[model samples]
Target chain A: MGNQKLYKGSLQTIILKLLAQNDKMYGYEITQHVKELTKGELKITEGALYPALHKLEAEGLLDVEVAKVGNRLRKYYKLTENGTKETANKLAEMQEFLKTMQHLVNPKFSLE
Target chain B: MELTKEQVLQIDNYISACGIKYYDVKMEIVDHFASILELRLEEEPDLDFKKAIVEEHKKFSNNGFKKLLEIKTDSVHKRFFKSSLKHLFSFFTLPKVIITIAIFLGLQFIMNSISDTEIFFNILQGFALLLSFRLLFNVNMRNNNKISFLSLSITLRFFNVFHLFTILFQFLDNINGEGFNNIHLLAYMVLFLFYWSGEYVYYQNKKEVQEQYPNVIV
Candidate 1:
């Protein structure tokens, strides 16, 4: 697994990106999807995921829909208009940070 | 494999046993717990359900469900606060300002006409008390499986206005019973309108949640 502390700041970015693509997802699905996509290298604990989701909801960055599926109510979160805009900004910011980190860590390396 | 209604109830009981008793919080955890348990059952056909539940519960953070409940409550409180502020601000702008000014003038007129301020103070306190009772009455009118953190937090936001009154009471006591001054009237206006706007916003939020989540009470 990747160092979680390093990934901590990026959790919101990662979640925003996923919601952008998937339209909507519930709590467990987000965690499972992240783990599956990263091949178990990234694991989102319930502790981190929920607070982030609730924070986003409070900020009006996301909207929630609760549905009865099988025997339980599942809260599906979708990006608001502001959340979509924020996702783009966050993605750009993450890309810029990645580029800067790469240049600083390996000055001699060139992707070109 | 889908959980039977019995299994779902058992899971709800298990989460409640873990001390996360709020209905909304329990609903999320119960569903997540059952999902993981069912996945485990699929992977290992002979897996013990009770043992699997314990293992899955361990997978939650060290603080477990209590931590989730805390953060969720905090978020709900923040949202209600933000909404209250928004409502209060709206009265300061556009068409609503007219109504706000009228209410302030009406209160000012009453304070000016009264010879003794004590009666005015008592009437104001009675009005505040009435608002509190009305809020409680509205909540009691709703039927719920159990109170969710959202409902509790929203209801509490209305009561928080009373805390401001407490502060004023303490301030007045410190000053040794000074009669109602102009400043006091202005403070009462702000508090009264704030309480009114906050009640409007917070109660509306509770109503929306009740509509959205059938199991959650106002």
Candidate 2:
């Protein structure tokens, strides 16, 4: 919870995984969803979330859809086909990193 | 708690006053602010609308909105460049390659047939005039309507500037009767094709934006 810096590198992977599971999400929806799922242990700030989204979008990993809801236009971010494919790779990379970190922290743990 | 019309307008004004000029970026930011404000109000019913907005705005501390605008602008420029590069490379693809070859040969033939360099310069001048007028007209239209410039508009303007530079080069290179050779003509045609491809891509982007926001006349 206090290690936001530790989570920084995994943010993109986390987002790709989330979008892989859910079809689409907006900025606030994403932050709130992450907070709810993590029981407030992790918080995705707007500053971090937006730049990540824009970077993914520019990289062609995500597509955007703007819809008029009530009186304002809401922009939704969904994974592109490329993004769907990338999600698997990113998740695998994160999984490997997590295993490495676990082994480093718990020295007595066996690789098997 | 849904935001009222006036409340939404207030949020929009706040975003604009923060220097986020692009309409697309503004819409996204306004929506984010609205969502956060609504959630805050729902959690604490006693919080006033303005107070909730201020609370939500505080979340984007350290001039986060400006950073967001910078990111949005960068993303737009990258998208435009990527799409234009895609179009530029498309000429080398299967069926399109044949068209490109034909256009090249046609330009070569025209250069060979026209002994008068004046006619060739006239043609170039005419095209330059037409494109300049088109660029001016579009810019004037957008300005008059207070429409925010999109990435496509920025790309088109960049091309217009490049095109003007090319015209200047041509003017400077003008010699008495030593007209353009076949190689020069081919290069000119390639440049023309590049400009046309960019224009076509901009047109496609404009069409998509118009469809996306049918309520707004883009």
Candidate 3:
């Protein structure tokens, strides 16, 4: 389900895919969602996740909304137009790579 | 039922250490954590609120908040740059520029008329402009971005006028072969350049300090 070398490189694609499916999420919620969906196969640390989120926001790929929920202000992130288009491209690329990996791992499987 | 005053203060200190610039955001996070502790106490009546809060905090690791603080710095840097542009714009204008030209022309006239006073006054004028530039850069160092446009213009105009007057005096002194020598003029230029270089080095060090100890408090 996960590879250590691929983790850092594909983190943004993984985030974009999750956000595309879920629409919007806060920082902690994104980490929790990834953990659950991967069945604990991938654990994204808060340290790694936040800097990426901030960089994406600065680059205009993400938009943030601060909502007052109870006594707390929860910062929610949603995909911007650029982010949405980026997600489609990244997902296609990931799928192609996965297919290539499968062929290399079992070349004997004669599947046309 | 409620957090004690000491507990609230401790939480506030912890949040402040995280280096968040927005006080309201920090307060909200502290309040959220306190509420969570209060809820935990409700389920386990005898549970120590402070201990429970600490335990819950440990779940997310100390570095989590620090990383979030770093993320916030990008926005703060943008605001800082915008303010600097505003300050720079306020310094340039018409009246100020005109006044500088007038000073230059006026000094030329004065040096032509009173050759006796030309050398002394010109040296003084240039020194004063260099001094004023240093003072303005010092103010920038202290982060006073709200520079008044009108005041800065007036000050800069006065400096330009003085500098021109000094040059006129020096030229007259040179042509007449009296009052001051070439060495004196060279000395002033050297001093101005040295002062300017010193200011550049000071600001470069300031940037380094900012990078090492980033604006994010945590």
Candidate 4:
């Protein structure tokens, strides 16, 4: 929440990275996983999460499987082949972005 | 703690009452509500089901859900159009490509040979109407399940895709040629391709939706 604006751009990358690690994830599970990973630093609101998931799915980067869980049907999303390739590409892009940001915004520059 | 069928139905009714009618959309929300309600009910033994659902629904406000539907419609249609074109291009392979080209040339020949081009336009409009009716029927049959998928709802457009052809009528009228020119030929080819692509899309989309959501509503 504190750095939500900063994290917003990386939401899709975050999702792909997560799906790449975990074979598949549903809506709530992705949110909870991020919370657990970030130790609550980032909370994925349902409002922001579903649209991202659906968009990725539409772009053919994700595939969905609906399963009956207990009394309700759960929609699970897994990365497609395109999604896997895209994950690698996005992560590489993110890495380069972070390096650039570190140099510009948080450089370990000390006055010599 | 798991929710009872009655509890799940309560969530379904609550979501349906909230204007989220599509099963594909509601399934995720209902599951979210169920998962959270189960955890909440377990955490508090005396919490009311209505109260538990309300708590979860507040997290995803009605406006948020509306925003979700808007994004969903835009994205799904993009996917729908893309998938249709993908399927259309799939015909460009062996054996089938032969048939495709043959049928295409055959139609071109017919267009060139026919003295009255009116029949071709009539067939085009009729075919377009037929597609609308077939896709409309698909939408209805899907709705018969009490909860339809959102993609099916996108097919509810009555007209306008082929309305451009009407303006072409005036273009056709001004021409003093015996047969269609390359311009007119190109238009007919595009319309035929749209007609074929739409048919294949309608067929494939129905299968995909049926596969996506089974009869059980949650």
Return the top candidate by DockQ: 1
Question: In angstroms, how far off is A30's CA in candidate 2?
Answer: 1.0
lDDT of each residue in B87-196, candidate 1, tens digit only: 55654666566887887788888888989876787677667667656655654334244465655555664656566674665467457465676677676667676666
DockQ result, candidate 1: 0.73
Candidates' TM-scores? 0.79, 0.84, 0.50, 0.75
Candidate 1 lDDT, A1-112, residue by residue in tens: 7688999999999999999999899999999999999999999998889989988988889998888899778889999999999999999998889888889999788433
Evaluate model 2: give its TM-score: 0.84
Which candidate leads in TM-score? Answer: 2
Query: By descending TM-score, how would the candidates be arranged?
Result: 2, 1, 4, 3
TM-score of chain B of each: 0.74, 0.76, 0.40, 0.68
Compared with the true structure, what per-residue lDDT tens digits does model 4 show for residues A17-37? Answer: 999999999989999999999
**Model 3: residue B42 alpha-carbon error in angstroms:** 7.8
lDDT per residue (tens digit) for residues B1-218 in model 3: 67666776676666666565344245434665666566777789888755776675665556746666555555434433443345334434676556645655564565557656545556555565656555556544333443212222222333344345445545665676655443544454444443443344334434433343342221
Model 4, CA-based lDDT: 0.77
**lDDT per residue as tens, model 2, B1-218:** 89889989998887778787678777877888988778777898787876666677788757858788788789888987887677557535677667878977876677678778668756865675566576568654555575565665566667676457566646754653465566566656666666666666666667767776666666
Clashing pairs in 3: B19-B217, B122-B166
**True C-alpha contacts between chains kept, each model in order:** 0.77, 0.67, 0.27, 0.79
* Collision pairs in model 1: none
DockQ, per-model, please?
0.73, 0.70, 0.23, 0.61
